[model samples]
Target: MTITRRNLGLLGAAGAAMLAMPSVVRAQAPRVVRYTHFQPGRLDQPKHAAALAFKSTLEGLTGGRMRVDIFPAGQIGPAPQVMEQLRLGSLEMAVVHDGGISGTYAPYQVFSLPFIWENQAIAWKVLDGAFGAEMAEDMRRRANIRLLGHADNGVRHFTNSKRPIVTPDDMRGLKIRVQPAPVFVKLVESLGASPSAIDWGELPAALAQGTVDGQENGVTNILAASLYQHQKHITLNGHVYSLHAYLMSDRFFNRLGNEEKAAVLQATEIAKVIHRGMTTAQDANAEPILKEKGMTVQRLTAPQIDAFRQKAQPAVRSWLEAEIGREWVEKLLSATRAATAG
Candidate 1:
């Protein structure tokens, strides 16, 4: 074989061209966020708003190198199934309710304490405070995921096929649907009511068939699910300040570079603002919408709410101190107090 200078020169040009290319070209494949939510997508749905923001902000911040495949209306199984997928690294992200987290992340149940936060402002103050950061760190330490941020969910209220609920005794003899969490079970049990456990996806049909008299959900959820059609009255117990957790699997988060990780985290922080704004802004119009549906809305006085909370809180507080650490509970209360003072 004869060696040729021209062939050698061509090979040298090819090597130089290869060296000019980037070592790691921006990831073009869709990042695939198997995100899930329990709400149907509509013009006014807050979860949808948040999900869209998650998709947009994440993709936008990454310059379209990353993409999210959102699953709304329980398209990717139910909330529990999605969380399990998250644990196994099959799913990338989710904004689940604390009740859903209670199954795997027990500390998250702290947010589900019945009749806790006085209003949205108080809830936001505490959730966005230093204590909230501590709780988020705890989840990362124990639960194999990073706490992204919190999305807003209005107060959990009671709606039943029966009459108005003015007191805890009024909840008696009713088989109300509660979350699968123990706190919810205890909360309903404290009222002498038969607590029925059901997932959100199945609640509507159950209510329609009388399998359950009613379910506790935020006013936004009640209106979204059109639960008014099944139940005659809505008692605004505001028993629990509903919470939506923004979560990211540590498995995925750990794989990213420092700047990419910061982008994801910062995006989540801004999402909390979008989440709260979307929810609180919607509250003023929710009551009128509920009334127009012909379902009566019950607003209890401060004394009435205090009466129920006094009984319910002790059970919840005792249960928490036993299940989670007393120190953690104290921190939560301290955080609440600090936020109120501010």
Candidate 2:
């Protein structure tokens, strides 16, 4: 029973009634939800705030029927391992970056395609529109997981201590730190950098000890992690838009009474709003704060950015086709273009 947008309209009416069953009502009276994130208690850490907000909203929505137990700072496992735990039903819920777990659901990589989103507003519209909902349905079918929705982490920009990366030629020969994921490594390598796979937990120390000369991330992340202390310049390459997911195990969700299930989904949606608001707000305020902390933020112009896309797109798109399917990549690109225009 694969879900599609058309079929969902029919099922939704029938589903709504069952979603409020008495057994569900009873079960959720003492339901427990386990949530986790790698970010600690920093005001700039949106995931941390999303966890707290979800707990407060879910319990309130359920009239104290559900209790949320959240683990912060990667207590259970690293970023890549969490999705497997969710699929096996060992973990209840988690907020994770789409890039880290796209191996399990290759279609999710559609969001991580470099230079796809022009800005957060356009990205937000697509994620909140039918496309995001459709993607969530697809994930449920493929990976037995529910994408609660997209959460913003800001635009990912390049940072380097070696030299200013104004163009693709500048990225050459610089060994940059990359997430322990193939797609990210491929993106950096496509741009001519020596991509080194690194865990998020060790990035701070890696930077501090000069293990890696540079990396790419959002302004909010750079400031929050104090990466400015290691990397001398921030090039607003804005290469990729950073997106995280508020994910739940479909198996676990399916086992719940309808009302309990809805409660959980509703809570996840609330967290999405919290996550987006905090992260975007952080990015909005980061320029001044980053300047105060002595980090130089450089914005690239059209000609320079065109040079980057031309150099990197062929390799990145080719890799995408190899990993997934050519047809799928074409579909995603088409949808993104449509999303962009609208």
Candidate 3:
């Protein structure tokens, strides 16, 4: 065991190798992101399609330094549970509907202020601008979730088994199922329908079992969930321009290197565009899609839609002003006006 010059040199080389091995292993190991959304994993489904694009694009961008494992159709859990996981850093990312986002950040419900966005373009302008940035920052501060981007959840319209809702009066005395968010409940109540708060997982069963006569959703969701099979009628009132928010856990995002973060942000923008395009196409062709599915599709006149808006907007705005704050409600209104003008 006497140390010679050659033996000492060999020991030093082995020691250096041992020290470098850990760093090499760490560099070679890919960071796995658990991404989830509440849509079927089929390519036809918007969320899944976007998710696939994100996975491929991000992996390519990072040259395999990152790997995304997607859990579509709520494979891990329902929206609320998935969101909780995201907040706690058990999950890395999610594309969640506004209703689910509202559960974590109540200010998100301001987007649900019934008939706020006249069209998708205006909605996008508002969401991609300063107001959306401000809200994203606030959400990060409050909920520890980073808003990557906002995409269309589709323009929500009313669907019923009993009758076609041509006006606010037609919605009266109907039991309409809505997402489990207070703003939706208020919106339905304001329009005179009895709103039943149901989780997305339970909605199809609720319609089939007559737990609720009808429900409201966008074209993409109707096609995704097959809600059109149960609801014989749909009113394309475009009452609410819904949103699917791309979210990442602040804990996970902050841990990434600058290049990785940039790749993630760029990949999310790509996915957001795909999501919005698919959903927007479905919304634009809603009438034909529903009619082809054997559902009675009702397209309301601007005046008819105006009547519903006048009735429901004020009521929901008042309720929201009390719930979140008048400042948020007013901020959205002002943004909408500016976006519309621009």
Give candidate 1's total backbone clashes: 1
How many residue pairs clash in each candidate at the backbone level? 1, 0, 0
Q: Whose lDDT is greatest here?
A: 3
The C-alpha stretches of model 3 lying farther than 4 A from their native spots are: 1-23
**How do the residues 90-169 of candidate 1 rate in per-residue lDDT, one tens digit apiece?**
77888888788888888887776777678888888888778888888888877777787887777788889988998988
TM-score, every prediction: 0.90, 0.87, 0.95
Model 2: worst 10 consecutive residues (lDDT sum): 282-291
lDDT of model 3 at position 222: 94
- The alpha-carbon deviation from the true structure for residue 29 of candidate 3, after best TM-score superposition, in angstroms, is 0.5
Tens digits of per-residue lDDT for model 3, 1-342? 799999999999999999999999998999999899999999999999999999999999999999999989889888888788888988899999999888889999999998888888999999999999999999998899999999999899999999878878888899999999998999999989999999998999999999999998999999998998899999999999999999999999999999999999999999999999999999999888889999998889999999999999999999999999999999999999999999
Q: After superposition, how far is residue 321 of candidate 1 from its true place, in Å?
A: 1.9
In model 3, the worst 10-residue window by lDDT is 77-86
Scored by TM-score, the top model is 3
TM-score of 2: 0.87
